[model samples]
Target: MAKWRGPRAALAVAAGAGVIAGLTLRTAEYPGMLPAGTPDPELGLGLRLVCAAAVLIAATLAYLTFARRQDEPLAMTCLPGLVVTGVVLRHLVVTLPGAARISPAARIVPGAGAWVLLGSGVVMTAAGLAAAFAVRKTA
Candidate 1:
């Protein structure tokens, strides 16, 4: 049988997940004003920019994780995983009920975008951790 893959496959998964996450965010109808004081067109543009930046960052990090060697420190291998986890946790905190108490509009309703983001985050985190484990195993 062919040798099993490692970080490469995980990296691809992460990239795909990031793309989906970005698209979801781009098309999703976020409640309330985005910047609080911006005009509608500017706010829309800003949101698009933010979405693009997020996707770029995620994809870049995934690539970086894949590029690291198996001999690298485990902490280094796990850095991207940690970052991804942080992003997901941040989103959850901002969208959950506690946030609603702070700002009613922030409460996340179950929508395609929200669901996609949640799913993508789960996949990205899992794949990142798996990649780190594979690196450790092969080191």
Candidate 2:
């Protein structure tokens, strides 16, 4: 067994990031932060955190599997970057009041796509955190 110290650290960081991002996303809200009739965004922060963690875990597992095979370095780097970009975007959207001006649901209702974006951001943040931690541990 090729000691899983790297993966373990990655998982831990991913879990932490997920919790943080979920809470952040939930906080930057307007009336529950869901598209109405969407079950009040589930358990809000907790659910988002779990979703983020799962995404990170899945991506980390993929990296481990590919590294074992030794033929997907390109894919690994690109995938992680894409995930980071998404996370960053979500963070900006949530943190910036400017984004709120865009009317997430101008043609629909307020805070419509914001919920979806927040959810996606949660996933990406987890993946980015996992990759970042795994790489740091290895290096």
Candidate 3:
């Protein structure tokens, strides 16, 4: 059996950390960060779905990395990138003129959840890239 070492191990750790961070963001609410009104239901649902997808991807990455499976590192790299894209899209949706007109509360600044998601994505991406590089060097 191949031992977990180097970049593969690091990727697994990073993925696990992302999963934890995403879960924390889901449960915790930041008061006063959002305006004193209900947020756009569709936008909110989209954000939640994106977060859920990220968490799932991270979990899968963690498993594959821990197992030392190197079959699809490149494809794995895209998972974190997708998470980052989702976060960016969420920001755009909140800040767009149409969003502001739909709900004045849309002007509210992003809360801890946004920051956590961004950070998690960054870490996951970095770790995935490092693992991919290691895989290339070995192959």
Which has the greatest TM-score? 3
Please, what are the lDDT tens digits per residue for candidate 1 over residues 1-139?
0133345445545644664554445323447664453222211344335445555555665555446543233223234434444444454444344434544554434345444554554555555556556666766
Off by over 4 Å in 1: 6-22, 25-54, 61-93, 96-108
RMSD of model 1 against the true structure: 6.1
Q: How many clashes in each candidate?
A: 0, 0, 0
**Candidate 2 Cα lDDT to native:** 0.43
lDDT of 2 by residue, 27-131 (tens): 344543434433232234544444455556545655665566422221243343344445445444443344444445422222433454444444444444545
Q: Model 3, stretches more than 4 Å misplaced?
A: 1-16, 19-43, 69-75, 92-107
Candidate 3 local lDDT, 1-139, one digit each (tens): 1343345546545654664565455322323454445443233556666666765665666666556566354337546556764664556454444445655644544445556656666666666666566666677
Q: What Cα-based lDDT does every candidate model obtain?
A: 0.46, 0.43, 0.54
Ranking by TM-score: 3, 1, 2
| TM-score of predicted structure 3 | 0.60
Model 2, position 89: C-alpha lDDT score:
51
True lDDT of residue 139, candidate 3: 73
TM-score on alpha carbons, each prediction: 0.48, 0.31, 0.60
Ranking by lDDT: 3, 1, 2
